[model samples]
Target chain A: MTPASSAKAPFQNKLLPLMLLLPQLLITLVFFYWPSVQAVQQSLYIEDPFGLSSEFAGLANFTALFKDARYVDAFLRSLFFSAAVAGISLSLSLLLAVCADRVVRGATAYKTLLLLPYAIAPALAGITWMFVVHPSIGIVGRAFIAMGIEWNYLLNGNQAMGLVIFAAAWKQISYNFIFFLAGLQSIPQSLMEAAAIDGAGPAKRFRDIVFPLLSPTAFFLLVVNIVYAFFETFGVIHAVTSGGPSKSTEILVYKVYSDGVVGLDIGGSAAQSVILMVIVIALTFVQFRYVERKVHY
Target chain B: MRSFIAALSLGTVLSVSALAAPVEIQWWHAMTGANNDRVNQIVEAFNASQADYKVVATFKSTDYTELMNQTIAAYRAGTAPHITQIFEVGTATMMSAKGAVKPVFELMAEAGEKFDPKSFLPAITGYYSTADGKMLSMPFNSSTAIFYYNKDVFAKAGLDPEKAPKTWPEAFDAAKKIRASGHPCGLTTAWVTWTQMENFSAWHNIPYGTKSNGFGGFDTEFKFNNPTVIKHFETLNDLQKDGTFKYGGRTTQPEGLFVSGECAMIATSSGFLGNLMRNAKFNFATAMLPYYPDVAGAPQNSIIGGATLWVMGGKKADEYKGVAKFFTHLSKLDVQVTNHQQTGFLPVTIAAYEETKKSGFYEKNPGRETPILQLQNKAPTENSMGVRFGNLPKIRDLIMDEVEAAFAGKISVKQAMDNAVANGNEELRRFERTAKN
Candidate 1:
């Protein structure tokens, strides 16, 4: 074939792949990107959907939110919640994945048990925890009572926060573990063998070879886990404490949900959504720019 | 080939006939537990009573607010059901949907259905009607706040269960006794904003706002931070400090606590009576909510708490007729009495109340008449009538947020209430600019 025909042949080869990707691209734009843009636009307008009336409020909703101290408190609480979830889930999961990677047998069994929580729906996970920790009916509460611990979520803000945080971490560990397991298995075992032969200790082998290989995976999972912590566990929070006994467990996403869905302040809710998106986007951008680069891979 | 053609034609004819069944009126509601069983019974009775209509009831899950949101989204997409049970606070939101909703009064009038708005309890139907008494929606399970106490627990605490507290001071005494008796929870409340603030404003005959709490116009301002409210919250704060009162989160039924024997006393909607009466193994007694004895016009009246059935527009004319017929059937006295008996909602009509009384049901069930007496003890003032402000749902949220803040000791009750009032006024103004004529 001539040079021009050869170049044209490559283009022809890629045509099928491009066509195959079109449907997913369309779906993403329609379901995700389009709604995201609309949510931003909606933040700028007060809508009475029942009356079909819309008014341009020009950042008034955001202004009002800034003035509302509860919003600020919730935003700050969310930061702590997201960080804790990311720190706890990522660290525990990495350790679990590493230990399982060393196991010669029952790896699959251990993994199946560890990942079982991920299979359970987040809502169900929340309810299960609620039953286990309910002050009157929950097993944990019963145990606490028996031990003479005056443990009541309805009165103890610290205990309420601890319970919600534990529930969130419990539900998220499975997700992180699964990802970490896949990442651990994908690592080249030869590198570790080479490190071991060089008289490097287990810690040195992990530091030089295993950890470096896992960094890229860890980085990706960090972003996913943070986003999940910020948004996905609102269901759990809602089912468990409902942002109570004193709004101790109230996160930004739960506030947005209550304001939008329960309060029926669509514009206010949209403003909260916009704020949440900005936060997550900023965190994600920073991660991509800084953390991703730090990964040796 | 000849036999195959014959079979195809026969199947087509049968399918066409099967598709010709009565148009099913789908009702989506948030009733569960014993209430769910009651709803099923009602739907079965209604369906069995008529040959031309089939009323199918579907439990759409908990969270009435979420249910309303879903219904609104579905309505926008032109896929809402024929009827939906919206909580009382949603009345204004539904009313604002001019073309999206069909007034039940007009439907009943046009269909020549025998109905009188006066037949129902004024306190219940009045909330769901227009200014001139045109019924906009059908009242299904309306309830007002009542005080419930565990008699056995009260006796254990050395308080007379037969003579329940009639004022806040008395209530505090009882709560202290119960707490001193070593119970973890002495007293708790549900729907704090609704029960303690909105209904409190009415029950004490205090003005909740100017413009009759937005019934007259969209320029209504909140008066939640009034002196009575301040005093009440101060009392609650003191109780909290003393470990005698627990704010059981917004909309968390304290009735469950009473039934579980965790709490000795609870103030909750009378609608929860069915749940407690059926589930509570302990002896319980219901009483009217305690008030401040010193306040002028104290103990005026309590407002409604249950949901109403709003008829949405953009339906087939036949469907509108079907919905109207269903409303008429639902309004019958016998049906209303059955509804009241099963759900513990106050009978929406006076005739139903009379019917319920004449049948000796209230005699058999002592607490059955508490809600009626609470509603009919005094005529409602402008504030005693239910709140109808635009963005009131948002206001309720703000109030609850502040209340929770107060409970957390994050802010003084006065400061929280003041903040809520200001923030709620801003929301009201925004709503006014958008929807007000």
Candidate 2:
């Protein structure tokens, strides 16, 4: 290790990290955390859905939420969606990251091309897929019809679920790939050089040195991706299927929206939001407290 | 400190003078495209016709659903518009808000504007009228469901284009023949719940729900899962499976499919006539929605499906007066006739309809009078009064979800309707509990 570089690394960690993270932390508190607390408060009460004349009803809302089978079914569906999205996104992103790391030329262009889908908003992503998969209008549906294979997603529950998962995974893979690329680039090249000199193969280098160093980034991406699946991808669900074909795409956040915005049941909507927050916070806390320790970096 | 006092007094003087200026009534609505253009034209005409009041109309969003959401949010913030156009579905919600709304009768009386509820059409006006026959909100654009068919498709199918289907069996046969003629879309319906369940029951003289579809009280639960509704949903599901009927998703927007020449026949709001008249390239015809053959008085009256203008609270006396004056201007027979003729919405007033009739407008147009005739056929039954349930939007989504399940083959028609009824009852109970205190 270079003594001078080692000396500077501690200085960057001491006060610099906090300074760099301050703006983001403040923004998260204001925009995300505050509204979340309000959502919890609103949920534990009887109020107009439009946020007026709210009176406390204690745990009645929570009790009702538990009693409704729709809530339970929707919660389970959200778990499936989030888990499927996180697992698929991580696997695909790690594969892309590994492939890109092996390449010696045009890596910059490859990284940009791979991360492009992440730049599209979730709403637009849903619309883009809807165009390509719509039974009557979409190209894929047309091709299936031409083959005399009746492939209307509107009537097929399995196909609808598959399309939603695929679309969500496609959007998230780009983001995970970007983060993995950064983590891969940060690993010391000297370690890899030494590994090659020690008669270690590419697979051994990746397994021994590279993967261990990337664990922290992988953990971080897992938490972020799961949270994204829970909250951010709701726009996709709303745009494409609108929890359609018999509530097959009805996730937690979509139910919250449907209850609050469309159903005009503010209290019920708030209850759903509070439950969603708990699920997200529990998963996030688990990732940070338990999963973070496994990372070698 | 002396200069600050002088400046404060000066500002107070200027503000007082501004308050003494002509009243401006701000209206927020969800009219867009051609309807938006019509709204602007009407507001401009009203403003030009008056000098003491200025009416400012704003096109807030694309559809009534979104606009209502925003309006409710705005109302919560105490920054709501002087007038908000709430859709027919929102009527119960708006009315349930207690002191949030000002009855149109009171607004007119306070403003010294002449208002007579008897002048408006019985079917359209009764939707927003209070139990004692006072108008709660001014009916802006009223519409009822009607059957629309493609004449070209019917001719190609070797069916008589001159005669429209009068019974459900006939419609089913026509749909099959039309699909057999090579058109992918045979028969499709928009607002499947509203057209096929709610209005369908009303038109066929069948009970849609208990307590007169919630119009009698807030305690109504969904009972459309009964034999008639089950039979109807089963017929639709069968046709959907047989490739003769397409179930266009929620809301009355089948104009897209119809205009694109995809669907041969559709049942949607009479309000969509403007869009179809402007967009349809092929010949089209309109008829009263088909009824069941078993019911003795099957061809019952259809209910209205447009929006009404509710005067919100927390406004000044003069502003309310201005709102009332504007409402009076909007309710004039001539203005109602113009709005109906230009936008294809049903005239809110009997005089407006008679005036148009005497002017030979309906005679020249022919199908323009079908909605009025359908709405005026007989005394509206208990089912025809319209749905008015607290937390109706939730009940609506429950129905939509279960119905979509039925369409997707996940559940049978009977099962879906049963689920919808159970879920809707749960929501109603929840809403009833909330409304109690």
Candidate 3:
């Protein structure tokens, strides 16, 4: 059946269209936009957790955040963390997806096994990694000790950051793998065959033909992975490192939770959230303007 | 007409029974595992004892910070429980939310329950009390930082198995000997801020902050970067450099090091006794927190850690009555003694302490009494009462971060303490602006 077209047969009653959209419109307004607006408004005031009293602080909260060295450090740390997570997750997933796509035997079993990690919760994933690499009890941790490496992520800032990055990237790889496989499969096999008959090696054909065709998926996954690293990986950081080892792993979202929810600094936390929102918006704008131009799609 | 009258009478009877149903008071807490089971037992006992009220306790989270966050969000949304178990660090935050909490002392008195502030341990209750001696929250599972050492390890190192170090220099020397004896981790600690900074300051009778350690007012400033604290951190830094001390993860993660027989000694919360009793395969004992013997009035008294039960405002008068009844039940000698014995929490009431002593419970369990004796050894001075300030959790986080930096050899002890004080003061200032009336 042909999909219904709004252009060919417009709604006879204008009010019916609005009525049809009312539920989603109301939900979006109530849940998403309203909270965003409230965060912006709350950023302008200092209030207790109980809402017993409030004082208009204007831009004082934002000013304090900028002046604070830790907040600035967290912003820069978030950028570095997001970039590392996206880069590692995408590249590793791409590699795995390429290998899995080339397999003709037991491909379903291979794909299912690779996708298992995506089913684990972020916090559980962090906890599992913690167990595997714990300095005292973990397998890898014991191996490191056996080798006399003196591995202790508990006190080492760089080690803690690396641990969190590994956990975060590991969790996102399955998601990227699914998308990359789909993108790779969607590419015309005829083109690769043509390039192969021209005596091009497998690596050359993949580099020249397969890689270019997969740019759109790569671009999309980049945006998604960056966002995931920014906002969703706090659970991993919280569970594994707790932004510890001298706050080396403290990113923007975790800092917001630490200061706002855990510390009960409503105004300061709200201000941080507002700043993060603007950063994400600006990043998205830049990606669309500059990065998307390079994608074939 | 006669059948209709009988039906109306039956309806009246059912409605009356429904109206007379017991008042149900909700209690939200962070206790988990065996401790959570103990909470359920207490609530069940209270529920069975009376028909007027039924208390329902819910375990909200595994950690104090998450529980506090949930409670705060619930309070803001007007769905707060009638009672909440808040950790000791949140004492100042709960106290500052003036109208949001109903002081336990007031609740008890208003409900005409027998609650004598003098009956409670001053050291434990003082942290949650106003300057005027008004107790703000009901002391629940209180604990203090103490020294835990492996007796087996001590014997292996050719040290006195029964004796624990009472001074910093002695502890350091023992740690060196332990390391020389082939111990991988000579010594470690958990709750670094609590055991090292807050309790350390109190145990030495040094000011952690101005204004009676911030128990007096909101204008208090952090004074923990003093020379004594700096010296203590410097000693720790030196030990870390010599492989005598291992830096553990923040907040009780190092307890594993000691449990696994990797660390010979640990300075951590007394409440960790339950876990040690359950898991440790070696002989372990407890001692008072070590102090610098040269300092005057050193080792005065260690302050309470753990949590307290606070009554939330906006609850009904009947619910408040139920809360008062529950608190009274909890303060009974038998209940307190059982809790203190079972969970390693301090007995809050003097009667409970005396009863436990008379029953020879301390004699049966050798190290269980150390926390009580340490808390009762001397009257808490103004500097030793407790550290109380708004935004205390955040301040502790900052301190922990800076201290970790120092321990990691990235910065000097002096620099770490200085940065902690500076950053902590900024947090305190922001808290004052928002929380102060």
Candidate 4:
């Protein structure tokens, strides 16, 4: 294929080319880079909610955050939470996709049903699970009581964390499922048939042929799922446990929201936002550099 | 041609008069449901009573935290409403915003209204007042924590339905009886931080924090780990051990325990009365909050728990005048009484309370006078006035975290309170540093 840059005709008018790119560049600047720069600048100052007065505090906000035991706890908790959510969601979606892929009859119906959950809002998904597991009024809650087990997520920190993780993972499974199914379908059936002719069982055939071929899709999904768990699950946490029963479920993004928006600690929140942004960038960079090397494609 | 000229001149004169329309004032509030309806009723009545101003009330958000955040954002954007209803916990933040708010007392005086701060109940106004007894905000829907018990459950439990527990020990005994009577849950409380910590400290006439619970200044520190608080939590821990006190979720979630007939008693805000009356299938009654009975100077007045109306600054003088007139209209005895009766909020003015009593309203509703009597029972001491701090909402969250830990048996009661004090002090120091700027 010809290189696109060399194949394109030379622009007769430089201003026309510049004008063509203005809208998208302006959008990126205003919506992405400008706010990020402002957040960085705001991290260096302490200001009240009304912005009546502000003082340059240097790195005091970051230092204080590191000293805060709760903030550190939330940080570690978020790491575990994201890992669990990503692992569980990726595995469950892959399993479902494999099962659906083997079905020849009514596969469209099964795929359609599996993809429906992706359309649900995260907060609504959390609420749905919360009601089903509510200590007093939930169906599963009543079953637990009848079985003589003490089940109250409101006071149980572990249970609260588990419930939020489940809800968040449940919301993300459909997205991963769609991607995995598409990847599985795009793989050549001839490879699997050749492996079968070599006296390979289903598991061995999948491991030897299909799974290796799907590694690129899996790698892409890993980064997306980790980022999803880190940022997109705030609504689930907010609706389910509110980082409550003693802050067991409080994630980094929720902390940013509570401190900046609700508590009106503008500088502290802005500092938190900057730290989170850096963490995401580093995570993405590590994924692309290290994880991508394992992909055969 | 002369007749046509006369008609054109008359039309011009009519248009000029229409240009001088009534001044519109915006009121942003967090009230929902029936309380929101009452707000509309009051605004409509005031608008109908006068042609000089028209008040437009807007439901800004569903709850206090969201409302306060929205108001602050709007204030920074230079588009804040003329007046806004802020919860009691936000009092200190509003007061610290110098030049951002106009003192209600000064507004009334400047508007040539005959304003008497003393006409209002001191317990209510003292919460929203300065050291010099100047009212900062108009007390709109002041309420205090009170006891609510299911009368049918009490009767089934062989306890006197006419009398409620007046002390903590008595309440514990009643809870035991209720449990023995096969009730699913014996007792529960809502707003644990408020009803159990803040008001609990004040009802025993003990300090919740230094500097009169932060009303004095920003340098105040939390003092809720006192012996009385520890002892109270220990008793609650024991109650939890025997299943007499069910651990409800934080805030108003436990109110459902009582409403659903699972729990027999609840200690929550009097503001819950309207909901109980509307949704409860069983007969219920209100009573004064139970005290420890052993502490000296106990059973002091309970502090307010509802929101108040504060006039925002940077408005036209005519808008301030309109706010002052609206405040005057709200403070009238009939209006205050109607609000108190309809919404179960405390009547802010003494005259309104007396008028309510004389009108035989309390007599018609036997337990309706409990909140008013609780507020007026004793003059408020420094500790019992109210809590004020810039980061009170965040502090409350810190306390809730530790309290839930204690309830879950992950920590001892004393340890929980200590943790709350330490973490809350850190928050206060942060607020102090920020507020100084």
The best candidate by DockQ is 3
**Superposed model 1: Cα runs more than 4 Å off:** A1-19, A57-73, A103-107, A141-159, A185-190, A245-248, A274-294, B1-24, B37-56
lDDT of 1 by residue, B300-359 (tens): 998888898887788887777777788877877778778877776788888878888888
Error of 1 at B81 (Å): 2.9
TM-scores for all predictions: 0.89, 0.91, 0.95, 0.94
Look at candidate 4 and give me any clashing residue pairs: none
Model 4, chain B only, scores a TM-score of 0.95
lDDT of 2 by residue, B1-437 (tens): 99999999999999988776678898999887767888898888888997778989988987787888888888778888999898888887777666777888888988889988888778866778765577788888888899999999999999999999998999999999988888888898887777887788888877777887877777877778888889888888888886798876777545577878888889998877778887899999999999988987888888888899988877899899889888878877778888888887888899999999999999788688999999998877677767677766667778888888888877788999898888888877766655553
Candidate 3 matches the true fold with a TM-score of 0.95
User: What overall lDDT, based on C-alpha atoms, would model 2 receive against the true structure?
Assistant: 0.83
User: Can you tell me the CAPRI class of model 3?
Assistant: medium
Alpha carbon deviation, residue A125, candidate 2 (Å): 1.4
Candidates in descending DockQ order: 3, 4, 2, 1
Q: What's chain A's TM-score in each predicted model?
A: 0.89, 0.84, 0.94, 0.94
Relative to the unseen true structure, what is the C-alpha lDDT of residue A43 in candidate 3, on a scale of 0 to 100?
95
CAPRI-style quality class for the chain A–B interface of candidate 2 = medium
| Between candidates 2 and 3, the TM-score winner | 3
Query: How is the predicted docking of candidate 4 categorized under the CAPRI scheme?
Result: medium
* C-alpha lDDT of residue A192 in model 3: 84
Better of 2 and 3 by DockQ: 3
